[model samples]
Target: MSPQPPASAAALRARAETAGLHLPGLILAAEQLAAQVSPGAHGLRRAGPGEDFWQYRPASAGDGMRAIDWRRSARSDQDFVRDREAQTAQTAAIWVSGGQGMAFSGASDRETKAERARLLALALAMLMLRGGERVGLLGQRARSGRLQAERLAEALVAAPAAQADFDAPDAGALRPRQRVVLIADFLARPDWLPGFLAQAAGLGTTGVILQLLDPDEESFPYHGAVLFRSQSGALRHESRDAGALRGAYLARLAERRDWLAAQAGAAGWRYVHASTGDLPADSLTELWQMMGR
Candidate 1:
């Protein structure tokens, strides 16, 4: 699959500035945010000049003149200088739910829940990348780089997310401080979330989860003998007694919802809960603000 088109930070910021016009009060600007997200040892800096010494290279066009290290240039007797950049203020890792059950949410207009997930994934990735934060895919393949943000969108567009092994900690050394932003339906209580978050938190990581709930998910709205298949997570059922279990089902769903919120809150995680056809950016900002970014 192809990585997303590489849009300059300015172009991306401009797009985000105008994206949520459909919903008033939902618009936000990530441009002014400081770089603090680092998911690995290398500071997650934009491929431009800032604070940390990311790498050095011979001076070239578009390279900030100040980035040239004169001492190195003198030694080589060439135009060589240190290419310093800002420390990644945040590591915005995105977790998309591709559990088998996510497919239950049927298509709308020309899009299915899968497409919506991809859209959210791309939009948020762009927002974070635009803000100069390091953005990466979580469930599918996690990566962090200036242009790697676009890879995530293309992956989502090319394939549905594979089931996430939340228990498996991400590898590689990230910046000491990082922020993780998750987007998922969280349908099944998969046995992986707590472990993942704990590991990241150990490294001074904060989290934000955008719970994407489908309408039918909250309600066992299906009646009659109906067969269902799961999307990413493992859950299958052909309920004949759905009517009788409706009350218990509702109660259980409510309990799960409350528990999820409490868990995230207790862990100092920012939660942005949404359903299909809903707005996600405004709440995303709220979470970014909460981490003191």
Candidate 2:
């Protein structure tokens, strides 16, 4: 197959602007998030096949001469063996939607959903790295170590906004038994989600959906003569009495969540929702526990 063409500079600029792509702030947030989580919070307790030092044991006949920790052995008459922590790192694939809808932030104090998604995505990646897990974007190569999150942030900012549509990830490198986390507003009805998730499960990928919502979207807090604009510039609707639509709007929202949750459950995937006003740490902590299970 021919190689794919690179995205235009204009498209890259648009995605960054819409997503409020701030690398410095994102890095800081990821670091802070890492600090908040207790070390090894992701159920990574076993010691084997890892880089970090675990413990040393007395040398046995089967032990290789090279396995001896000479520095420590010199301190004692008996030979001791060196052992590294056993690595049980799993791959976590993340996708934070850069859709135009994610650009909407209802209040000045609130962060846009896209920015919040990126923060959570990167922060989670940091946590995964600390746990000795491989981290990757949904359609990208997996990586490990402390700096993987930084690289992901750079790639995220460079992606074109037009590529934000809900599409099944290219699973060429996606192996069986890996985890996939999808962060999105999910405002539109995803008729394809059920099949996509089912196929993902068939491929041995467990899924997690983090549905982001704006506070105003959940509450429909507007009253009297409200003009609502589509973030994608696809539609415009004026409400003479926005308050009147609250009941139907909220009902529809609830219905969507219900449907999504049901589909996720059927595919053995986890579903969680959060508002932009909610602290990212809380949601991430919850997600960590879920993924651990």
Candidate 3:
């Protein structure tokens, strides 16, 4: 069996009780990372000698018993943590592409691409948030700095399965100096990537573009004649030329990968392309180390 998690990881089994669901170990493991960074929240809770201080407030009907402060209750007639004002954390925002394409899983038995994406996104988000960095989620419904992992997971499941048109983010919606992490498969047309990177570079912001893809995306593993369909169902193929087109198809894919890497180098962005088969924990930890974390 895996060794017992760090004591700080108590937040996980604890969070599930609040969410009224059995959240996965992935989230708990990510919470271990989150403990590194102090997350900011608005509420009534005890403030201790932690590097990051959080104020708690009177218990709302929804607060879990775990979040309650029995010590404060013993002192005051009211049950609560010290209700402090809401404060913003100095955290980087993580924008995960929620296009339908992420929902695909080529042949992974553990989970689908979308599932992996969720695991990665949530883990990263929690990790950053723990370090006192506010996490802003970008998708069809963008939200940030909220203790809503369970809600976010549900949203990921219901989100529309289409890559963004790869265009500019909304004007002023993205800050230039903030640390920004962009995670996506980036399988869509490549029209908007240049502008996106250019704008981010101009802001003097350093970040990573985590491109998550299946093995097949890198290697066209179609050995036999077969029908293929895009996530959008806009394209359908009945092909017998898998061998004939294999060469051209692979060449085009290489060019695209090279183009993406070249663009990142030009704009001073860290690029990490992760395969679904990769052990996400190790890959993500390596990424942080590469970032000089």
Candidate 4:
């Protein structure tokens, strides 16, 4: 597939200025992506104390007499219990890392990690909203409806640039039993992560940690006489034979991914990995399934 054309600075600024008045291109793209997935029974069609009818099943020993549909039961020899669809909307908070490292793209044709993260976050939020779930930024209150999706897009566009090389999730923003989606490249191993996961477990907050990386970061395609610099220019390394470091670099990357996966599992959450080169819709499909679970 052809790469998406980069947005001009002037156009971006104009879109930001008119954010609330109309849907931005980013939101439109997210909507298009979200529309691709079918919103089939998204864990909301379960039997519960809701107004809408879900299904009818044979009455069991524990089934209360009030729940028994006598009208329907009369037609059949066995008694049936009326089940209603669960109407409780789940709250989801999505966070994209605002780190300097996220702004780096390996090539002009590829999107920056930040760009991909925001797109996925917004698209996932749109899908959840379509499934009758409330969504918002990590630090904000979750709300339902199309307006909330628009507000999430606006918030993502207006987010301030990063001043640091890496960022950690805001544990204080988490609420009990709230679902969260955090998208970031954990190259630096956020020192706050362990504590955050512990707190999330304590509060019963389940979530998914998505590790997004640039193709260059994943492959480390450097050769002789290379200089590597952090996105913030806070750190630098020069190597006469950069290709020789590939083995060590890849090993560390794998170790980090394993560590993250273990942490997520320990906390009853899930871990997902994706690269900018992959299709956003593919990752969104996986996220949709995880959220439904």
Candidate 5:
């Protein structure tokens, strides 16, 4: 993969302009939705070095004087050792498919698959940040906090072109023991998935795949005199009657989803499907619940 495009001043401004119409709303909605989920739900619980107070235990042999809480010891008449919760934040590597197919939207009321996937990524990042976890784009290094989300969102929108039909992310970018989330239409025949999953497993990275599809892509609700144009504009198919293709299309879609689920299981990851028409908050909530578990 080529080096990530630097976020120069011009590049940042162009990214902002590219997403100007959607950015504000996306950010606000993400913040509001993330606020609904409590951070403690995903916090790591243990006793170790940390800032938050956990509890006090009776000081024992080998305990250093610095470990004793003098104030607490005076009150209890016994030497007490301060213990703090070791809240180790997890790293979540996130990816959104920017395939040409993702630009397809079935209706004016709904956002394009790419738009919905990007917004979902941002929203999920907000939730992870609030939970005290680190987040990064799949090919990038992870970072924590709200500011990182802004930086990521900017970079996501700034990329000049969509990924190839079956381009897998660079697994070398992933750190061991990290969690990953991928949001994509999954319309392409994925020849690269098995190798990618194998590498991810080798790196000790567990993952979740969020399959986002447009309503029309799922239902195939079209009839007479239908013409379909490929998102890449490389092909066109015209049909005297599109309804005739519904059965086969639906079957193929089901098979694809099933294969995705099975492969995710084999790789020790979970898969979830969401339609573009559904509430983004609901998907975000479900993902958070799954990660916490």
Candidate 6:
């Protein structure tokens, strides 16, 4: 069989626009998944400087006279200080890989890796927004509120696809003190990742890397004769006994994941592995809990 032709620039743009048409549905799915998990510490309930009253605690020796709430003290025998909820919002930036490789799916029943990544990214942003945290795409300005979530969904769906087989995180976009979430397959062995992590460390930016993969990629369930082509049709491989490759493939995959985990650890960042076939809510819940910490 002849190699497939690459998609024309116009065709790629049209495809991206078509993807935009599903933004509403995608956002709804993400919202539903996010709703499954409670916001927990992500919410603005921590005691700090804020307008909303959080709790009243007994006055301590260090408490200033003016800090005491006389009205609350009058209600109780002991002096009390009114504590307000923390209004400070942390900034979270999310990036979903747009590489053509992400468009691949092992089976018709499973979502494309890109779709799964986008869903998780958007859902995570929604949850963060609910907790009063500012959220945005990695290269965009982080903002808090319902509108920001909508914008994030649009951006995730409408972004142009990467021409390369593997897309690297844009480390140059790192902002100081920003928490980032990068969702990608990481199968291409991104040479730029080490540099990106170094840059993030320099900027004091901490984050988590959620490596999303198709179940087929993880299990290597090929058998007999098989023809493998990348989504971009830029790479091709034919095997008469594909099953013979399983052991080596699995070993390499494990090595890749180990490398990723090590790199993330060196940077004081978290690393998570997820398969597209798994329940998205399960992954979302894990991410939600991790982000809260």
TM-score of 4: 0.83
In model 5, the clashing pairs are none
- The lowest-lDDT stretch of 10 consecutive residues in candidate 2 is 162-171
Best by lDDT: 6
Worst ten in a row by lDDT for model 6: 39-48
Q: Give model 5's TM-score versus the native structure.
A: 0.78
* Model 1 per-residue lDDT tens digits across residues 59-156: 88866777678887887867875766655445656656555445545535433455455565655565556555666765343445545644664455
How many residue-pair clashes does candidate 1 contain? 27
Q: Is candidate 3 or candidate 4 better by lDDT?
A: 4
Query: What are the lDDT figures for the candidates, one per model?
Result: 0.56, 0.79, 0.62, 0.87, 0.80, 0.88
State the RMSD for candidate 1: 14.9
Cα RMSD for candidates in order: 14.9, 8.3, 17.0, 7.4, 7.4, 6.1
TM-score of candidate 1 on Cα atoms, chains taken together: 0.57
**lDDT (0-100) at residue 100 of candidate 4?**
92
Mind sharing the TM-score for model 6?
0.82
Measured with C-alpha atoms, the lDDT of residue 95 in candidate 1 is 56
Looking at model 6, the pairs that clash are none
Residues 1-293 of candidate 4: C-alpha lDDT, one tens digit per residue: 98755678767777677655534788899999889877654545688866778799999999999979999999989999989888677888998999899999999988899989988999898888887888899999899998998889889877876898898778999998888998999999777888998999999899999999998999999999998999999989999999999999999999999999998999989998999988988988888788766
Query: How many pairs of residues collide in each model?
Result: 27, 6, 21, 0, 0, 0
Q: Best TM-score goes to which candidate?
A: 4
Q: Flag regions of model 2 displaced more than 4 Å.
A: 1-21, 39-87, 163-173
Model 6, 1-293: lDDT tens digits are: 98755679668778877877898899899989998888744434688877778899999999999999999899878999999877678898988888999999989988999999999999889888887888989889999999988888888888888998778778888999888999999998888988999999999888899999999999999999999999899999999999999999999999999999999999989898999988999999888776755
lDDT at residue 287 of model 6 (Cα atoms): 81
Which candidate order results from sorting by lDDT in descending order?
Answer: 6, 4, 5, 2, 3, 1
Segments in model 6 whose C-alpha atoms lie over 4 Å from true places: 1-17, 43-87
- Deviation (Å) of 287 in candidate 4: 1.6
After superposing candidate 4, which stretches have Cα over 4 Å from the reference? 1-23, 44-59, 64-87
